[model samples]
Target: MSEPAAEAAAPAADNKKKKWLMIGLIGGGVLLIVLSVVLAVVLSHGKSKKGQSKAHDTEQQAEEGDAEGGGEEHADAEEHGKKEEGHEKPKAEHGSAEPEHTTETHKPAEGGKPGDEAALKAEADQLKQDIAKLQHEMDQQTEMLTLSDEAAKLKSEINALKEKKASLEGDKQKLAEGVKQIRSGEKKCAISGNPDKRLDELRACLGMSQHGESKPGEHKPAGDSHEVHWSYNGENGPEFWAKLKPEWKVCAEGRTQSPINLVGKFGSGVPALSYEYKSSALTVVNNGHTIQANVAEGGGVVLDGKRYKLLQFHFHTPSEEQINGRANDMVAHLVHKSEDGKLLVIGVLLNRGKDNPVLKPVFDNMPGKASEEKAVPNAGFDANRLLPASRNYFHYDGSLTTPPCSEGVKWFVLKNVGNISPKQYDAYTQLYPYNARPVQAVNGRAIVEN
Candidate 1:
């Protein structure tokens, strides 16, 4: 019994054991398959890593080749620069032999690295701009210096011109003074061309009156030039005239002037006055000094048997002949000249009581304009009636009573003076009112009473 049961059970047990063995084997095979697949993936990854490392080596080789090629190109460029430099030297040598070099060593050149070339060109432009500014500044300074020099030169010229102008002004002032002196002398000559006046049978060609100052008849002196003219004013005035001019002795040396007094009583022993009328035409001249009427072409009067020419006639107020120690109203002097030019004077007194017809012609036509000539009426006039009927007189040697006081005048004053009205005295006083000279000393000269 136990054997059969044991055999069946063993088979069953063996089946069970077989079943466990199969499951274990299947799990081991799956594990083995997974391990093989993992091993195969690792092997494939190792091969891929080897291939990438080779590719990296190839890329490094290519970079090395490019570097070598760039170095060779740089060498070729350097070699070409040396060759060009050598050629330039030979060319420069040839060019220099001909006195010129087309290529220069230090010449400005182009074509370099762009950045470097541009930077150099900018530096050169900056230098050129700076040089131009410096040049402009220098030119301005030179122009300023030139202008300063020109201004200095102009100032010197202006100073010289001012000096010349001042010299010319001084010369002009001297010329004007000289001309003024010449004009003054011309005015004086125009006043000296008139004749003197007297009454009687005598006359003087050149006549002057006796004053305290200048000499009479100075112009009549012989050998005197025309410029030796007599002056009644200035240094040639009456009192000091002889000191200025030597020929004016009549003023300093002469003693007497006309208008004397007849003091003595009338007597029978009086000498008769001789008179002769012998002139034809007469010329009346109205000078600023006095009125004078001159007889033309030798008219004369005979006194003391001597024929004296009637030269001129003039007037004076208040008769020069003092009757009873007193002068009459007016008197006329008839100046006469002898054949030798000696002078004589006959004085006639006029009264104012009645209008005397004898003096009418002379008063009617008196020359009014200065330096003008007039014709006196040649009507009949009796020179004898001018004397007093008693014929009493006083004789003295005197001078003419004017600016140039001339001596050697023979004066005959009547003792008796006729009466003249106040109207007749006024008529003569209206013209030359103060013509009478003051009485002078007789100076021991004889005074005869007729």
Candidate 2:
């Protein structure tokens, strides 16, 4: 009875031992399969992240190259921005798919051995590290995309600037062409032949004006030619003033020009003038144009509440300004200037009649040679005495009847004519028979009378 019981117990123990060994072997095989799957998944995920990181690095380098310079990479960055939307999905898919794979690895197989908690925790921690690495790669990609966008914007601005510069250069070339056309146009218009022509056109051809500033964007070309000297007739005369020197361009362009006709319907109320003049030293000289007398200081005239210091007095035969379309024998222009650089002129029209006591000293002091100055001390000459003993006069605004016909001169012409003997007239005519500029169009200027 003891042998039978011992044998049955031993057999039963053996069966229990073999069943436990089968369960342990099954659990070990399940754990090995799970570990292998996890390692494979982690390796795949690492490779994917590595590929993404490489792509991000390539994008960043391209952007950096664009920022460094050259427009080639700029174009590449733009291309990337348009297709960048597709690239983000891969990273998102990788993050979501990796987690799903992780969850799958974390789950134990049903109807099999239970998983070891410590091993599962270690694998989960490793997966988490891999996920963090993937996240870091995604962030890098985002930063590279931002840099690409900035580079694209900068490239756009650079392109726009390049276009603007080209436009400005084209405009400058057009302006130069226009300037060339002007230079070749009517140069004869520099004179006064065609008064109908607008002043601006003539000025443009010759670049006229004494104090003229160049217009904005204007440039002077090379090989410029200008007539330096001028004469009363022929190529350099008033008819051919278009090609004359730029300084004397006003002869044809001036609106308020000198020697303008005084035949307009004049208004009354001439400004009263007070002359503070006395006899002083005077110099008489023939300046190739007319006899001029330069007087010393202590002589001035006050008109319209402004005082003008006397500069000099000159004569023009057959008075430049016509009175009612009739010229006198000779006209004396006493030039003056105010403190503020304003100019004024007092005119005394002369008719060949009798000897002028006031002018006798000037004739006596006149030199035979041109530019021969003769000083007459205590000449006993006064500007007040030269005017006819009449307060009435004709007045107008005009310019000098000579080269550089600058306007803005205030002229006071005595209505009552003065006298000059035929002998004195002949004496002046011997030097200059036609020392007078022709009367010009009034051009709407007022010829006031008092």
Number of backbone collisions per candidate, in order?
Answer: 31, 8
Q: Pick by lDDT: which candidate is best?
A: 2
For 93-147, candidate 2 gives per-residue lDDT tens digits of: 1000112122211222333223345567789999999999999999999999999
**Tens digit of lDDT per residue, candidate 1, span 1-450?**
599899889989999999997787667556654654564455334434333222111111111122433443221110111112123422111000112112112212234345557789999999999999999999999999999888876775564354344333433443354345446652122223344422110111122222211121221211112213333333333456456566555665766755555555434544456655543555555443345656554455565677776666666675555665777677777776676656677666666676655455455555554334456547444445444566555666676665356677666655455554565456546654655555555555566665
Which stretches of candidate 2 lie above 4 Å from their native place?
1-228
How far does residue 355 in candidate 1 sit from its true spot (Å)?
1.2
TM-score of each: 0.43, 0.49
Global fold similarity of model 2 (TM-score): 0.49
Q: What is the alpha-carbon lDDT of model 2 when measured against the actual structure?
A: 0.65
